[model samples]
Target: MTPASTDAKAIWRAFERTARADPGATALSTPGASVTREELATLASKIASAMRGAGVREHSVVTLMLPNSVEFVAAFLAVTQLPALAALVSTRYKASELRSIWAGIRPDAILVPPQHAAGVARLLDIERQHDMVVPGTDQVLRLLCVRSSGPASVLDVRERFGLRDPGSFPALFKFSSGATGTPKAVLWTAANVGAAAANVVETMGLDASDVVLAPVPLSHSYGFDLGILPLVFAGASLVIRDGFRPKTILTDLVDERISVFLGVPVMYRVLNRTRLDQVPDLSSVRYHVCSTAPLSVAQIEAFRRRFNAPIFQHYGSSETGGICLHVPSEIALRPGSVGRAMKNVGVSVVGTNGGALPAGCRGEVVISGEATAAGYVQGETVHDRNGFQDGFQDGCYRTGDVGFLDADGFLYLDGSRAGVVNVGGWKVSLAEVARVLESHPCVVESAVTAQTNPRRKQRVIAAVTLHDPAEEAELIAFCQARLADYKVPRRVHVLEQLPRAASGRVVLSADDLPS
Candidate 1:
């Protein structure tokens, strides 16, 4: 299909056709109940109607700070139906963080569950104060309090406004990695969303016959692209996991007959800790899709021993969706590999000076395709190339990750450019160091970071979680043997588990490290 025809309305029209053809098919299965495609459409229509009643129009931003419930999905689909833009944010965002996100967005309305309504109001107030604005000086932020029971939305479908004609305007805002309180909400157009969903369907082989398990938070881009958008576009059943409880998820996988399992590295590590005596019979799951963070060799081995399936590592970012993926026709994958580039996507490694690096040479990983977002959205400034390294040439978004492409075009990730630790004069990969530590027999997971030494030089530090108690000195020596002298961790902090963000990436903060 051509770019103009493959727009958001076209994707949404496909969904409407699916619902008409098979209204009885289950579209969403959550902790509460199952919603059929027919019922989902009805609810989305009601939400869309409500959005119009609330004065939401084309290009109006409606920020949703809700949980991974049916309501969240309804609001998002409604936005696309209205051809209006929306931003999904974490409900657990701190007040300051909320201020940062809301202040930048000129939202037409804000959606929140009743419990969080007060917080949202206060956050808006903070945003006004932070920006030195008076009442009615900015866009009127309408508050739509969503109910937790009965229906996904409060507005009645009978009070409906005609659906708007979908155009080239951005429809969704996908946030970058959760490290920053101030998020650079990456704008995604309907065309971008459709192209991304189609890419997943074509490359990952997702279809209506599959039931997907999503433990990743839907608010993040990884989950939106992998978990929500693809399922909605394909008219497939989605098992929405509210939280990552092993027992509940394990039971649901079998009960729901999940055919595709989407998870992250931390989730796999936690599942690896389950006793062999009580492992879930995940035979129904054909594809164990893992992304967001890199999987260590130990983790891969542990998953192999625990389950009969192979975890296909996915490589992408908020800037681009599903850059490289594992397909059935690809050559056998190597360790630490994230498969090859998807259809219509181009990935290359480039030096700091924007020159392309030869295959097998480490450098910044750049992506170009329909999957790449429109770039960061701030107040009055939608920097179309803010996330790119050099500039936006050929639709490429420079992924801050440091990686190398092999001879066969498979991508090998060492770590992120931002995650590198400088030790005196030498630079080392935090992921590389953690991979070596996690390889230890007693270790389950690990995270490495940069710390200031007494000499005021940057030193490498480590934090590890072990199945069995082990000496820190012994773990350090193990890394010393596998890594170069400068790359070895100068100090190790033995912890039960590393502090993690909602996305399951290890959180590197002063509190997470030793004094």
Candidate 2:
């Protein structure tokens, strides 16, 4: 596909082209059934017709609550046919979270599996609702359909979906993981959607023959860009599943002849620790991609030694599409580098003065590319008061990430700027402290934070989940040896697991830390 054809309309067009080329080819492979490209496209059109009947216009928002399945893909594609915004609500979220997001979005219609109909209505306090089932696929998907209540719009067209010029027509509405703070509603324009899909397909060298096994939620950016968008751009096959299951995933890798694996750090950590009686041959798997969170060197090494495949680290944000991916050839040499800027994407590290920092200097990571989103859903953009800045031809997004790029343009991340804590007068890096703690043989994962003492002083603290027996004092001592005394954790808490969001990102508040 050429740059000229990469537009929001290209997403649906590309899928249609692939279906026309080979309709019988399997596009989505689920545990229940396999959906051909033609079948899926037809399903999308059927759902689009239903949505149109429900007063879904060009700028309407259609919320999706289904899990990762053929139903979700078809519903999302259906939204694109109408050229409306698909506000993806993950089924993995709790009922309260669902209600909150639904209330904020106030979508014209929502699509869900049959079982959640009553619960969704009750939670969202909907007095009247109409449900229609789209038959096909299988028993589960046969009952999957859209529920339209014809809700009144709360916000105007521009404020609701962030629709502006023709190039900035909203396509997707997703919430950030809120790892650093409260989750914000993000809007991706049609151009952003087309460019995101194209960038990943081109950068990763994905093709129609590649079968991607994705256990991540399609509602999130990481899964959508790497899993579903590739299928739209390159005609690749998608093996979608709801949650992570290491053993079952291993079985599918061989049975399904998987080519690409998409996952987060937590899933990789569990898979690294999973004991297998006999390791299945994964020769068919070409790429093992990890995103959402950074992978420690220990994790990268462990997975490499166990599977003989290097874990390719993917770095990006919801506001910005794919910023960088690990260069396969340099993965071994630069163990922690997140690769140079992605194809057609420009990455720069800027200092506090907002000037681009020299190579090898750590600063805030700013991404400028065709794939970058317009801004948040409330009509913010690169030139607005938001973190985004306007300069590059396509505009730039301030990623709020702290990292440095080497002379060769390879990017290495330390952590987020918000991850820094002030203890006494010295500023301490929580990620550096956590890194030292996680490096200990017994620690599997760790989270570092700070708390204010009675004297109004910030106290650095840490928490760790260990694979073997270990004490808080030992972990604290371990960090003390590596980090400066001021940066060393004043206390360490031991836990079986840390609280994480649906995206597998460690979301910790000061209250979440043990006193």
Candidate 3:
């Protein structure tokens, strides 16, 4: 295998070569069926050939909106083979959100599933209503529709739109919810992605013998990095599931003899809630990785006890790739820690003055590494001289998380520096409160913030969406029991749905809740 630094395009070429070397080996598996390496490569080749015939060239931006399936993998690799930029858009995004994203970066072409054509057409209509000019059609172009088991339609949409390759384009554009209250797209190059993928494979000690079961959506960072990229790089078989269901997941794990399981804390919590006897014996699995959100000490320990496998809690953001992870050896010793920095990544806790702090002191966690991204699409560059070091000094990417490293090199997260709430001099982490509220039985989702109180200065308020409205008080009582007196929410507001951005992060506004 070639080193990750060889070139971003080299990784795809290597995978294509590997597929040819072991044509009959299984590459991807889902509940519906499985695809051999030969089949996977042939499908990708067909798609790439079709794209070339349709006038796609190097550096063209192709927006992909599809569900998690074999088609997604084929489309992603097919575009990358031409070294074209691939933008993976969430299927859940609304028309308004789509307009905002498309307006900023006009993609040369778009690939949507047949099922999403109507919703996409609706979005184009909404765009026209606002006098916004979409890229392809007078309305949105229903250009490419993926067939179940046949050839892909290559319409003259590319010629119709008069699109052409501009030049060298970013490898991927992932939209993230910005702190300034808007959606910001993060641009990453093929080189950056290849480095990040290599870092993950090395850090996790993955091998071709490993079988990874992924239940998270590939559009998100966690799924894309840990779930998809590592498997592709290591030539490991991927067991792709559309979504997470504890019972079904457990059954698949045992049946597939899965070696690696990656998911979020919420998924593990759901699995832990299932009856122990009903849970399959996952003795074959060696690692269970969790990220996207924090995993409580209780949840971590519970998962370990039930599964008899080490549960690694990792911490990272979409801006920078995998930052920190708790090692399997330290699982028992440092239950809450996210682990030491991975190879080629620098981790630091800086004080308010931007100076590096001593061990055991809480400060903002900053990271720099090979996996760090170039920058956001239209947002400010986060790299700084004192902190970021021009992207070379130790290659450390400054992570915005607030955490501290113990004397033994274990990283303990305190909270996020951006989302802290000052309640009359008492600092509270909104993430901490949100975690407690989300643990409630009736609460499906929750967002916590500091609401102004004329007399008390500020009070903790929680806006929540519940499965049952009548259980609001009961849920509040549940949170009151688990959280500290100061951390407990003083007021709980029930809503049919919580506001969220296209990236799936909760959106809170001053006028949305009580002040």
Q: Which model scores highest in TM-score?
A: 2
- In order, the Cα lDDT scores of the candidates are 0.70, 0.75, 0.69
| Candidate with better TM-score, 1 vs 3 | 1
Superposed by TM-score, candidate 1 places the C-alpha of residue 250 at a distance from the truth, in angstroms, of 2.8
Per-residue error at 176 for model 3, in Å?
Answer: 2.3
What is the alpha-carbon lDDT for the whole of candidate 2? 0.75
C-alpha lDDT of residue 161 in model 1: 14
What tens digits encode model 1's per-residue C-alpha lDDT throughout 360-408?
9999888888767766666544556433423344567877788999898
Error of 3 at 190 (Å): 1.9
Please give the lDDT score for candidate 3. Answer: 0.69
> Which pairs of residues collide in candidate 1?
none
**Highest lDDT model number:** 2
Which residue segments of model 2 deviate by more than 4 Å?
Answer: 2-10, 94-104, 114-127, 137-166, 281-283, 379-394
Cα TM-score of candidate 2? 0.89
lDDT of model 3 at position 313: 84
Error of 2 at 341 (Å): 1.2
The CA root-mean-square deviation of candidate 2, after full C-alpha superposition on the true structure, stands at 3.6
